[model samples]
Target: MRKEKRSSKVKDALGSLTQDLIDAGLGSPFTEKELNYYGINIPEIKNISPKKIKVIREKAQFSQSVFARLLNVSTASIKQWEQGTRNPNGATKVLLDLLDRYPHILDYRINKSKRKNYI
Candidate 1:
């Protein structure tokens, strides 16, 4: 959708070729700037409000402690985010965006009999 800077047909061709090369185990030769010119863009992370953060957590059915553990952050951080006292940034923001888009990403089944099988 961010192909406005270039011809869409050209961008699509280059993007597809780049992806195919990566999938075939040949590392990408294109730089990030080059990829962007080809219209292969990463989505920008949107700022999530306190209420939305609370909604996302509740929708995932995780307690603050569990969500914090999954995100490798402190329970206090979750509290702050939900209370509008702080904001998630960088990698945490990226992760939160992914969670917002894919609500079921955190779903996992516990196999009590096989510890290794638990996600």
Candidate 2:
């Protein structure tokens, strides 16, 4: 009898845990943000300013070449982005927008190169 009760308790706990997982996965309508990025709920960002993009790159203290390295894009591309001559596409746009908002997210990489200012 005790064993059956213990098993019932375990099953109840598991059922509750499963329901919690389903609820979190399905998203809560009452919650503020909608998009779940990686795992956490994040507010949606609609657009980015060309000026902020340029300032973000500049604030990283990395040259166009290094900044391009961070973005996995050509230096010419970064140049274009900074000059407002071209806009990033798809994933690059997402990445650039993130960098613009979270400039510190990329500061770690600048220290990696630590190359001479030969440029």
Candidate 3:
């Protein structure tokens, strides 16, 4: 009756939400990017030029140190990456690709950190 219909609707909503969370956590094919943490045939990352690196940082509106902090990399590593002496690899490469494609996603984390500090 009505109870069964309501229960089914709730289940459907929960199922959709669960799928969205999984898609967000694992990535959707729509992004054309996947991070296989098991070290399988990972997708190739495009070569990042010095100018592109600078652009990415500027686009994120983060200073080198803050960017490094967000990336969990050392400031020296950011400097080297920007100077073309080194390149991001592994998870760093994946993360950079994600950020390059979805810059606004960082806003949540940055805002959350600021809130944490204020508290």
At residue 91, give the lDDT of candidate 1: 92
Global lDDT of each candidate: 0.82, 0.68, 0.74
| Cα distance off (Å), candidate 2, residue 99 | 1.5
Best by lDDT: 1
Residue-by-residue lDDT tens digits, candidate 3, 1-119:
69999887876665565457665786334222222322123347877887788788888889999899888899999999999999988888778778888876676657564455543
Question: How does each model score on TM-score?
Answer: 0.68, 0.50, 0.57
User: Looking at model 2, which ten-residue stretch has the lowest summed lDDT?
Assistant: 30-39
Query: What does the lDDT come to for candidate 3?
Result: 0.74
* Colliding residue pairs in candidate 1: none
Question: What's model 2's lDDT at 51?
Answer: 77
Model 2 agreement with the true structure over 1-119: per-residue lDDT tens digits: 69999987876665555446656775333333322311334445554556777787887667788788888889998777767787777788778777766776876665656577875
- Residue 3 of candidate 1: its Cα lDDT? 64
Q: Which candidate tops TM-score?
A: 1
